[model samples]
Target: MEHPLPECPIARFLTVLDGPWATLIVRELLTGPKRFTELRAALPGISPKTLSSRLRRFVLIGLVTRTAYPEVPPRVEYRLTPAGTRLQVVFDAMAAWAEQDLPRTGSARGADR
Candidate 1:
């Protein structure tokens, strides 16, 4: 996202949620923690490399927590931090707006409509 002149606060937030993948990842994790394979299964659109890279960035930024189990067959799960969990409201509002307004504006398909 282009930094809006005059320093907008929402722009800073959008910088972290820069695209569909990041937001969708948050949405998936909102349901609860999930293993790598489960996230992949839930989000088939994202490639393994993209998912891995995005997850690393999320972890670095403290939006996500990664837990690895010690076992012969390792188990790893990704969970959202409290800050990340709060994003569910933002997503819900966005979804509601998209459903109600997008089609009227002819900018996007209103999936709910």
Candidate 2:
């Protein structure tokens, strides 16, 4: 069975950023443009395959841009588009909500066991 896309904004947001790595990838790119190797280094546990997949999706969805330069080594850089940068406000709101409503846990995820 096929399901129609959700009309709710939150659902649409989740439809785009569904996986655990999606938001994390955006967060990393939020700092500045980075190469494939640099992104892998910045995100310690992320597999190269996963990073590539996310970046590709981001580019397709107009959230990111991938620029390849003609150089001896073939340099490529990934940067957030203006729409992606707007997500910072969403992140900020999430942080504020979590600080006020969510319980304190040492771990970043803060998932209750």
How does model 1 score by TM-score? Answer: 0.80
Error of 2 at 28 (Å): 0.6
Clashing pairs in 2: none
lDDT of every predicted structure (CA atoms): 0.86, 0.86
List TM-scores for all candidates, in order: 0.80, 0.82
Model 1, range 19-105, lDDT digits (tens) per residue? Answer: 989888888999999888898898978999989998998898789999999977998999999998898999899989888778665
TM-score of 2: 0.82
Model 2 agreement with the true structure over 6-111: per-residue lDDT tens digits: 8999898997789768888887888999999998988899999999988998898899999999998999999999999999998888778778667476444545
The parts of candidate 2 lying over 4 Å away from their true place are: 1-4, 101-113
Question: Best candidate per TM-score, number?
Answer: 2
Error of 2 at 89 (Å): 0.5
